[model samples]
Target: MVAKRRQFITDSILLASSAVAFPHVAGAAQSKRIKIGQIGTAHAHASGKMSAIRSLPEIFEVVGIVEPDKERRKKAESAAAYQGLTFLEQDQLLNTPGLAAVAVETEIEQLTPTAIQCLKAGMHVHVDKPAGTTMTECHALHDEATRQGKTVQMGYMLRYNPAFELLFQVIRDGWLGNLTELSGTMGKYANDATRKQLAAFPGGGMFELACHLIDAMVTVLGKPDQVTPYAFRSHPEKDTFADNQLATFHYPNLVATIRCNHIDPFGGPRRAFEVAGEAGLFQIQPLEPGKVRLGLTQPHGPFKKGFQNVPVRKTTGRYDDEFRDLAKIARGEKELAWDSKHDLAVHEAVLLASGMPIN
Candidate 1:
């Protein structure tokens, strides 16, 4: 009888242990997955982002890819980046079982529309850069997302950049007191073929490239009272090339410039922006985060000094940071940053700058 009692107690303890273990085992399986879908391979940056999604097994599961263009699909498959991934039809990709979100890396013209479809279908969206050609499209898309209670994170990857974060803090802290002048350059080396391709694009360089700087400018200076755009087609007779262009924005107490061109050479360093105020100046170099240099007037000094490097909190590549942030928001860890309202403002800027009629 004593031996029987001992066996019963041992069995009860073992059952209790298993009860505890089962939840963890189940949780491990749950935590191992984040069903991510890629909904286009039209953007130049798509492959890089796709590869990153594939490599991070603990955080993501590349459930499917949606490729509309056969050429692009072939290229994606040939590229080592998409070796083991399955490409699905658009409808199938959108309706995939347990699909959490879709990355809209389509052509610039298709970005806003495709994103709208994804969000309407109860999936979160990760749109590529220069969200849309016109602001109205962006606004309509974001409004629908708001109504659906879904997220639409625009592809302004640099905002997640660490240096820009510090710059934001400094600007807000008045470290650069009463910012007066802001200037940014969006330029890159372009061959004949690239230039021709860009020339075919309307609004030329401003819409295609300068949007980044313009967005950043709006971020730093708020909405401007008046905008005087200086668009020029430098090689008008040669091709539909609006190579050199500028947008001069006038704010309450600030003036900003956006310079865009395809006149630079390859392998050359690209310049981002310089914000100057009465107290100090901040410079952000392209593709390098946490490299913000701030130049402040000594508490009491007459001499003008050069910029001194300021400490910027480091952040990892945007693909990881953005996804992690979105996941955290989804998991009730924090609030979403690029909310519907914020996206509306961004879209408004894109439209206003594009000279598109705002609705």
Candidate 2:
């Protein structure tokens, strides 16, 4: 078991090393690719991300997949998502040559450790949300990642969505002056399969689901002064997991609320975010299909308020924006928008809201 684990890590590390495009080397004139590795196949989203990487031939190469669990390994191998990908033992994965970075898409319990291992190896890491179970571990991993000069990107998918892009632009442009409050909701039908998959985690919906909103909240507004959570087991018999969760994060300048529940109807409101400012408000509904409503109030002249529906710019692919952004960072052409501190702060808020002990 120990040898197998070591081999998996080695292969993951090697696959993460990107081939250099030195000026003097022939055939190096082509654009360099960011070689990314995947750790653990337990995460359902891992396969989706792998497919996205595969589709983006210009940005990334899906090199190695590390699935330590026997059952998960078999399932991942047979899954269409794993087609045309190399599978390796953990140590072999870590030692893979020409590797650039690793995506820590393991079970929630393994997210932090896997990311730490990648960062300690002097490689960038993209970790899934609700980073870790404990605040101390989250901070420790973040600090180590920083010390090693690695980027620890938290997987907050909404940040890269096009509708939110316009909202953020309006706020930054000062069109919406003195933002005071913001609220966002991510609702999905937590069917039997989802319930079974999420039952493995402890914090239920708050940790498993709501972290996406919390991260978005922090992105639009800075860290909250206090985060108060009101959670419940809405479906006691459905599964051991907490099905209903809400957290109100307070800021001196603004107040934010994140609502997540496992009971949304199949075709109910998909996801939405509303930010209100002294001047006006901005809202995005059913974030997937991209419906945006932007309202602005007049400043000095005759008071006026109007709404405009901004057309949604189609994204190239699933999380493709994020992968391309990371490639830019690797090439020293872009600064890390999502930093380690932001992740620690977001996770800290989640832990606090859950009434979990924090360090």
Candidate 3:
């Protein structure tokens, strides 16, 4: 049985690897190509998401892109991803014939409102992160999607990371007897230009970065019973952005600590998450490559009782699997794993962590 269980671990690893591009999704070759239009290119991930969508010609038909800002549109249209795509007015693109989905990749301020527009137009939307400035905005976007029977796939980049996927498995299958601790740090250096942009919001680095960690934390331990936030300014004289930030989430059994900062000149490689429970511990460092270190208290499944590095497939593109899943959902092949309820929970946690008002 140990032999079988050991091999099962290998099979599990393969399962996650295959989901990178959804290369192994059943009937993908026959997937009804969902006509998808993109709105705006101001968000950082806008072009990347469009690139991923266009790469999957078998799954998504690029109906057109809508960017009202002439400067941004002209700048974006020249990009390789938008080179051959059409540019339409917002209403024109939203009302395109047979349009089934819209990727709401507008600016952070417009993310929720634009997604709400698409939802009210009877379209499923793949919205980029932070949801918006207010809990009310986030709730309205999701509430409209629910009323319209459409899906709202938020752009939480790490949802499909192989190591994080394994973490989900560990939590779900009781590999960890009971999740007791979850902690992560997400940071990146922001230049003057970026800092100026982010300084508009008090959440600062936490809102811009740690939302991803909060998404993962909420997955491991649902809505935090209480969220305690510590927001500080690393460069007080330069900007009002809360560049240095930490939020501790309290749950019935798990306490999750999340930190996000914009002053780490070398923080990218330091991005990491650690979790511990009664039975084992799992850690992923440099989350991009998803290097996994797992320790089991006793022999559990394929993992032996000591700390060891496990091979996890690295992602080719951060948003590839996400758009792939969006297509599958539009084609009625599957449902969103993180639904509205969960997203609302994550959003509320984000607001609390950033010390933004939920009301």
Clashes of each: 1, 38, 0
Per-residue lDDT tens digits of candidate 3, residues 113-137? 9999999999999999999988899
TM-score for every candidate vs. truth? 0.83, 0.86, 0.92
- Report the lDDT tens digits of candidate 2 across residue range 202-284: 66777776787777676667667898888777777767866677788988776788887777784246678889988888888
| TM-score sort, best first | 3, 2, 1
Name the lDDT value of residue 122 in candidate 2: 72
List CA RMSD, all candidates.
Answer: 13.5, 9.2, 4.6
Which segments of model 3 are wrong by more than 4 Å?
1-25
Please, what is the whole-model Cα lDDT of each candidate in the order they appear?
Answer: 0.68, 0.72, 0.84
Model number with the top TM-score: 3
Which is better, 1 or 3, measured by lDDT?
A: 3
Candidate 1 per-residue lDDT over residues 147-171, each given as its tens digit: 8787777767665566665566566
Model 2 bad stretches (over 4 Å): 1-30, 299-305
Report the Cα lDDT for candidate 2.
0.72
